[model samples]
Target: MLKNYVAYVRVSTTKQFIHGVSIAEQRRAITQYATLQQLNIIDWYEEIQSAARGRRPVFREMLKALKRHHYGLIMHKIDRGARNLRDWADIGDLIDEGIDVRFTFYFFGGVVWRGTDKKIERVFLWIGGSPP
Candidate 1:
């Protein structure tokens, strides 16, 4: 189901690049995961800069692409890929538009969440997953 995915991986600093914290690792890992699932990687993205200092304009551009209904997006490490609520909101936007996002580190909120699409009751269920 996630075969048609684009892999995104990033590291914030040159030190991370030289020290083996690189998108190459993300590609390899995503490739492996995709292979196991019998999926195909349609495209890939890598950023060698920080989400905090804004070294990933391209990454943001790519997120814009995700809104076009790309099947899935992959990130080797969640923190390396994003750093705040705005960025997370952007990610959620993609999901709301029917894009599946995968993070090697974070599990997302579990069920897909869309402020525009979800009913208030569904929102409540999502918020209170542990029901009585």
Candidate 2:
């Protein structure tokens, strides 16, 4: 059976909107990645607020849902998922709790939190062509 995942995408500034990193683009990429990985995306959480400013309602909602459902999380990129240290730490906490967090961007390779050592291992899985 395929693992259930929640997809989270965000765009903070107008610059990002103009640069083609719109929520739609992120969603599309995430959907494609999910399909390729054979993972089932049960829900989507999108935030237009800047993570740097803190207090994202949608993000908080997603976190709450994750805690309750124990579903995996897939984001377009690390920055989209978390631009601040606190938010990053939250994600780390989830990983520490055995929650799976994945990024759609191939450039990120893959991030895994090892046991008690707290070591992070990067497993690169390049699909095709050169790195973006």
Candidate 3:
């Protein structure tokens, strides 16, 4: 069966958005990863909020939609998804509710992190070519 997903991208500063760190890059990375996994991106949520802050309106709305539709969530990285422990806890809650969370790019020689099991496992994945 094809998996459902909702993509999210965030930037901390306008400089990041302007100086080549745009949402397009994030979405591209996510799209690449999703294509590799054969997952369908049902929606996208982009935000210009600091991860240090837990109160993100678009993030909240995305969470509500994910719960309502029972779709998985995708992000560029773990830090991009949640910077603080509280925010991480919120994500953990979603995981407990049986939501799959996939991190597209990571420094650990992989482009995805599937977190839907009883114990989160770090499976290595390379989308395009050889891992750098």
Candidate 4:
């Protein structure tokens, strides 16, 4: 089981950055999920860069940091995550390396995927309550 987490939170607009509602919501959800799963959040990377730009220095730095550590990556959702195919491919590579990629929105006790040649490919279940 993965015990550590590094969070990546992003906002596309300056307005959202000023208001901070989206970022705060994501952080709250991530914190709740971590608490329920008994996981430690070791680091956080926040950026105000737009996804359309497709060049987030902080996000790239976060990926590099992941390589030197043994922790899962957590984001608010896939949409808040990789905004392009290249970024998605990077996430896939991390999964292939047996790292967990968790989304706060889909935190149904966490989604588990097999990284090896196993018949049981995936499993999903609720932790605190019924599916929302």
Candidate 5:
């Protein structure tokens, strides 16, 4: 059986709509990744607010939904998933509860698994380059 997954796409600001990777681009990449991984995306949560901000209603909604359904989360990148330590910690908590969190981008030349020392090690080594 295919694992049910939820896709999250975010852009920090309205300005990003013009300059940075648009929501469409993130969604496209996530969709392709989901297809390659054979993940069944049962829902999608898109947000336009910065992850660094104190409040992200859509993100909270996604978290609530995940808690209820136990679906995996697939994000375009770590930045898209979380830019603040608090939010990152929330993701970690979900992982501790057996929720799978996946990033489509590779960091430090390798796959980054949630709740692993390797993920911590590679994130610090990340030099902000284009995804491979």
Candidate 6:
């Protein structure tokens, strides 16, 4: 019964527009996801913060929106999310609260975990993932 949908993209450096196409590529990927699912992205949040920084303003805004409870959150990649455990836990708490999460790429084929068990596996993947 999930209907609401939103897209989020981020880059560590603001110069990505000039140096590379990270943000553009991420947007295209998210757009593709939205198109495939026939969902209209109500909002697309983009931040210029590294995953190491837990207090990203745009990320905080996204969380506030998520908590307000409308649509779910979508992202280009999980690492675009958070590299630290605290940020990861914040996202986990959101998931526990029933906020839907979708990744641009399901490296593991959409393995959605609702319990703490698969969490360790995610942690392992986070630390030692091979390039895809």
TM-score of each: 0.71, 0.78, 0.81, 0.76, 0.81, 0.75
Instruction: Highest lDDT: give the candidate number.
Output: 5
Candidate 5 C-alpha RMSD relative to the actual structure:
5.9
Clashes of each: 0, 0, 0, 0, 0, 0
| Model 6 agreement with the true structure over 1-132: per-residue lDDT tens digits | 437777888888878754664888888878887777766788989888787858688888888898886577788778888678777777777777777777766622475432234663465456546632
Estimate, for each residue in 1-132, the C-alpha lDDT of model 2 and write its tens digit. Answer: 999999998888777765778988888888888897899999999777888877799998998899888999988877886777678667777776778888777423464322122233221212123432
- For candidate 4, write residues 19-131 as lDDT tens digits: 86488888888888888778789998998888765799998898888877857888878767677767766676777777777776765545542222232122112223365
Q: Which of 2 and 5 is the better model by lDDT?
A: 5
Candidate order (TM-score)? 5, 3, 2, 4, 6, 1
Which of 2 and 3 is ahead in TM-score? 3
lDDT score of residue 11 within candidate 6:
85
Identify the runs in model 1 with alpha carbons over 4 angstroms from their true place: 53-55, 105-132
- Each prediction's Cα RMSD? 6.1, 8.0, 7.8, 8.0, 5.9, 5.4
lDDT of 3 at 92: 75
Candidate 1 lDDT over residue span 1-132, tens digit each: 445877787777778776675656667677776675566678777777778754578788788777765767777665766586566557666766777666543323243322334442353355437642
Q: What is the lDDT of candidate 6?
A: 0.73
Among all windows of 10 consecutive residues in model 6, the one with the lowest summed lDDT is 107-116
Q: What tens digits encode model 5's per-residue C-alpha lDDT throughout 20-120?
A: 78888888878888887899999999888877774889999999999999999988788887777778777877787788888877522266544345654
The model with the greater lDDT, 2 or 4, is 2
- Model 5, runs deviating above 4 Å: 107-132
Worst 10 residues of 1 by lDDT: 106-115
Q: State the local distance difference test value for candidate 1.
A: 0.65
Please give the lDDT score at residue 6 for candidate 1.
Answer: 78
lDDT of 3: 0.77
